[model samples]
Target chain A: MKKDKLVIGGHEFQSRFILGSGKFSLEMTNAVIQNGGVEMATLALRRANVGGEGNILDYMPENITLLPNTSGARTAEEAVRIARLARELGCGDFVKIEVIHDSKYLMPDNYETIKATEILAKEGFIVMPYMYPDLNVARSLESAGAAAIMPLGAPIGSNRGLLTKDFIKMLIDEIDLPIIVDAGIGRPSQACEAMELGVDAVMANTAVATAKDVPLMATAFRLAIEAGRSAYLAGLGRVLESKGEASSPLTGFLQD
Target chain B: METKMDHMVYLDYMEQVDSDIMERVLDTVEQYDYNTYIVEDVKAALCKDKLDIDDFGALLSPAAMPFLEEMAQRAQKETRAHFGNAVSLFTPLYIANYCENNCIYCGFNCKNKIHRGKLSMEEMEKELQSISKTGLRDILLLTGESRHQSDVKYIGEAVKLATKYFALVGIEIYPLNTDEYAFLHECGADYVCVYQETYNTDKYEEMHLSGPKRIYPYRFYAQERALKGGMRGVAFGALLGLGDFRKDAFATGLHAFYVQRKYPQGEISFSPPRLRPFINNAEENPKDVHETQLLQVMLAYRLFMPYAGITISTRERAGFRDNVIGMCATRISAGVKVSVGGHEEEAKGDEQFEISDDRSVAEVLSSIESLGLQPVFLDYIRV
Candidate 1:
């Protein structure tokens, strides 16, 4: 069998699960990453600062790729500067452009995200823009050279799974890039459902971080995502339009 | 109804108040067009698994009234998803009923000829002892909007007294400065409840008439100040009948939404108290807010902010409280007495307003258990 891989910006990843490190404690970061079988992890640059509580980089394993996010950037210029700073700080060229100005909902500004994606992609960065699931905006981001478009399943940290299901489905059907669902995925079943819907990858943070056991929840997400990806690959069964179909041949029954 | 000197005081307080939040709320209220929503829009709003602000508006509109059953089911599912079957119980102890405001609707209005009183520290402790004996760990301390009679020092002392008996002490008194709220929080107040009586400033001005409460912006910012004071939680409410019920309800949800966003760690709750008849206004009922409408508002709030704590107070009837608790409400006020210092002895003053469900704590607990829900007294403990 041919091995499947999630390709973003010409980089291959065996793990389709992208772990968010924003909410996890530094002590648990490595365990959660290893338990979840994560090959890629996103971190805020501030958490990696040398003088902070403790540098998150020290806990990261050698095989993991760090996808630094521009979390505090409210405009395209600010996002670009943060991306450059992340690169200068020895983090890789991979950047998640999160240009958010709406303080209430923490909603991403697709316009600013597109601008930042263009600027960062031009500077030879693997740019991924977290966006609202709007088709036209997704197209613009693709045109602006975003490697993968990460659309929110719900508001950030809402633990609401696939509230934007219909729009995200439209993106999956139309957008010609890896459609990685991000944010608000609370339970393993939700992540599995997203994977079954054929999303290329899933990014989760709060759901696992706030769990009763962080590492256990991380493993649950990993298994669910893998099961979902396998199921998607296997091709899900069809549903009846009206009535139930018998599994054991109704006409072949002895009573019949 | 107000004197020239009262107008002078109102103007003086107005000068000292910040109006940025009020302006934002009023702008939202003025621009909200509930009438523009159609049945299709409401249907579309209800179809989504999770709701946004526009969907919230549609659910609160008249177009959504016919789909009340559907809304209730969705609200129930959201409630069960977020809060499970655990309903927290708390009782409000009115520590004082003295007011410097001339708000015409309230029984405790200074101009009203109602008996006024403030609880002494010993009296407050006795009341707290009586309440604490009921196995109720959460207690909210309320006072009429009067700083002169019930100052910050007196409220702080009452809070300090409450902390000794109750595990969680909350304040629903007059709006205080950030420093004053800090003082009360330092005295062990865990939460603050401030109802911006009405968000419509014009209606607010006409209704408030006079007093420091007439300073709209100061009261609007009370919850933010309370959060800044290091309180763990803050509750938002609006007297439902004071203005347009739907818009007022929307503004209440939006206010809490913004505050919760600014302080992500802060706990937010909602208490949608209708305009019950007070002493001066015995004939008054909620202008347009009936039971179904109030339920709709609460369901909308639950769908909008699933994590928020919605307190169904004893202001509603017993049956309504029971029905809504399983549907959307996460908290209830049991064994309530609005009069100042009434738990351990005879009433010391007139009650703040009438209460409909006068069920005792044990009865309320039994009722909650019968509905297959757990009645929690204290969900969080202060170290």
Candidate 2:
């Protein structure tokens, strides 16, 4: 039973978990989807037959939604080209725009991403942008017809989860589009915590793919995500900072 | 044809430098009385609210040697104030070692008997991939002044290729016309670096016997032409040992000073590269630039041009480079190969010169951090 199905570009998805298909064996994709039950998976558009494995698309199951990323793009025009090429490759309309110019810090250029989103949105591509956790940029991306905004939990592949949790929380409280936490998420609990924050989805590539057992890690992530999502849906209690708010009334003890 | 070694008859490069600004600086070199008020003038400058050109000139005098400790202290404070703790890292990839010039001091000189190599597009990719694996995001492309093997098109192509692996790309090669520089800029090179081996025209003529590099004024104004060509930045340097170090230091400082004033909006950086030894060519003569003087020149540079970048290269020993980096220098080269096809881990093919510090990029990075500074491989983001 799908409690909260994800809808993007008139396509309904049964799972909110998006697998990253880079830096891992393509053979693991089937097992990941089979066990973890992720509805969509993202791949980078690089030189054709990327990493000498032939087309990465051929390895993915036909049922899985492909979210092609603009990872090599250093400018808005570059990102747009990658996006257009992904669409031409029959990966459907979904595009994850990443325009990063600062290779040292590997931080996304917020202005350039907004520019790319405007261009791609007009071209009828379902634009999902990976960005820094800046609320103003999130608002601008929403205006640029982005399907959702995925902000980095930390630097890509760092596995240093939720370093920007406060900023992501602000984005979740304010922005209307779905907020999927991507990058630097190293553990299942971190993914679960993001879900408890009411984020629409969780995506982790290095955390699962780098594990000794990818499929097993994927299953753990799926269970944690479900548990967190269910807790959010059941209306989790508030965190009392000053003292504990007793779940049971203090005066209800039999001795009293 | 060789001119007489008389320093005056060969001030041709000096005469061709048509700027009143440069003329004023050279005239200061001709007229300043370094012997009269050397110590007091420097001390007075140290106490001044604002420093003037005369103050900068005084800082270069022999009398200022005693106050080097003070100069270094102030220079370090100002450097920290301006640049903070980030030491920007870059690696130099030699595209081609071919040369037409016979600069006696350089290993790439035409007369030097050393192996010359050039990288093809595929080889360049291999080198870049090796460099990229180290996670370095800034690169400087170097070549000799050879019109035959390393022409403008060849260099422009190299710069374009560099953009795929690096976010910031700079070129250090032959001087070009404004149009040529503009073409290279459009090819995605962000900066140009030209080291006028020595500003003293007599030493220049003696060093550069027969080549396009013989004309000093043209080489001196390469940065200006590069700026005209629309490059975001231009780097200036002098080889440091060929001429009178004091006068060369003043001229180098003054040249960068004038360029920064003219293109206040553009980026300007300075490097004082000491001559390093090479094969067959005794890289050093009896008259050499000593380490103490090298420190003084760099500190004086920072005192004069506080905002500009100063790069200390692998020419110095690692210990020396590590000492001056966070204090006066802001940029440095690491994991550098001065030969063509140098990126293959085992390939040391033909070195332009023997680098004093033979450390890897990661090794250089740890050295930067050990000194309580952050190592930044890239900074500029093209929006």
Candidate 3:
């Protein structure tokens, strides 16, 4: 059997879990990655200061890929500038475009995300835009040359888990690009359910950082994701609509 | 012998302004070349189904002035999508007019020799009862900046009294510490409105020469402290004409944006009050914030933040107020009496500023209905 791999921007990643490093210390993040078998990590541009004291890059493992995000940008121009800066810092070409103007809900500006994605992708950068789970916006992002479309399960840091499951499923069904669920997945079970629904990957931050044992929580998420992927590959069974059928044969062995 | 004013507890509550966010706002405003935007850019911004910060800038630029009709149409559509043809109506009740601050533009400044009165509990209840009879459910309690005359406890008592008559109680008074706001919130205050007055710090210092209000950093973070105190909503604004109106408006929006981001559960609102001449001083007027520009700012705010509550106060004219009922303004002040003890009795103190719309509550309600919008007095019920 061929091993299924999560591929984004021509890069292959054996681990499907994408760790978010906003609230966690760099050492904690490294520990979590090692325990959870993570291959990619998202770091805010502010935290990726190269020569600054206690730079986050110093504590990262060699095998992990850095995905720098434009966390503070409220406009498309600002997001483009941040993406260029991230590349200059040797963070490679992977950039997560997160343009937010609605600060109350911290909702992603889908219009701005599409704009930023188009500009960065044209500049030879792998643009993975974090966005609201809207099918129309997802299609626009794909057309804008996004490496992958990252739809949010809920608001950032909200551990509410997969509130947009139906919408994301629509994207997975309709869009040709990889569908990565980002933000709002608070539990391993939720991540498993998303995988079962055929999402390419899950990105989480607050769930692990808020856990009592960070690395342990990361491991739990890892096991759940793998189990889900295996189940999906084996094919989920049909669900009975109304009544339950008995496992034993109703037709006679001897009497009938 | 130690009085509450002597403690000045809010002095300890002053926090250093978040310099990063401030720098971002200042830099964006300083570097914004609105002139570089052409009609093509404005058209592009208008044509987009979804607008971003850049689009908002384009809409605010002079190039977009020729496209006012288009901007207003889109703004109205956005407002309808979020608010659903409902205009919230409330009235302001000035409980005290004894200000200690020496602001150069206000009527109630301590330097003015006008009547200064703080409502007694009896007078306040009478006023509340009188306004409550108008079928209005939201009341905003305001006072001039005088801690010695109107202490936190007095404000808390007024809030407690107001909660008895009104379903929603908001306060627009001197900024308070977190604990003070919490105490008022415990007294049933749901909203706190503090105008930054102007975002230009130098102009702010020059205008407010003396008093605790002179502490720029303290006033800048009042809404945050109020939210920290567990208030449900906070309103923000920049008094137009004190500085560059465009930059002030932009800063006000960004301030509300960032604060609401941190406190997503808190309801956010904007009250863009223009400068009106104070009592006995009718010569002062807003420098360049004309009606068209004011409408532009309001429309820009609506397109940028559709869900925010934008209050068009009585400072604007009655006809103008009527024209803007359902356009982009979601909230309107009706039957306002800005003098202490003026609603139910003879005026005891001078008015804060001249109110152009002296229409009765019933009149405002009719105007809202005439415009085919619902007049909402209370949208949410307390638990």
Residue-pair clashes per candidate, as listed?
0, 0, 0
Model 3's lDDT to the true fold? Answer: 0.83
Of candidate 1 chain B, the 10-residue stretch with the lowest lDDT total is: B6-15
Question: DockQ for the candidate 3 complex?
Answer: 0.03
Clashing pairs in 1: none
DockQ of each: 0.03, 0.02, 0.03
How would you encode candidate 3's per-residue C-alpha lDDT over A55-159 as one tens digit per residue? Answer: 567778888899989876767998999889889878999999988755456789999999999999999999999999999999999999999999999877667
Clashes of 3: 0
lDDT by residue for model 1 over B196-291, one digit each (tens)? 878877788778877788877777888888888878789998899889989999899889887887777578899999999877677887798899
Candidate 3 residue-wise lDDT, B1-383, digit = tens: 52223211236645543435556666676776677889999899888866676777787788888888888888876665455566777899999999889788889888988998989999999999999888788899999998899999999999999998887899999988888889999999989999989888778877886778877667878888888897878999999888888778878777877777677767889998899877877888789988898888888788777768899999999988887666789899999987887889887898989888999999998888776566767653343
Best by lDDT: 1
Better of 1 and 2 by DockQ: 1
List the candidates' TM-scores in order.
Answer: 0.63, 0.60, 0.61
**Segments in model 2 whose C-alpha atoms lie over 4 Å from true places:** A1-256, B1-21, B345-349
Candidate 1's C-alpha runs over 4 A off are A1-256, B1-19
| Candidate 1 to truth, TM | 0.63
True contacts kept of 3: 0.05
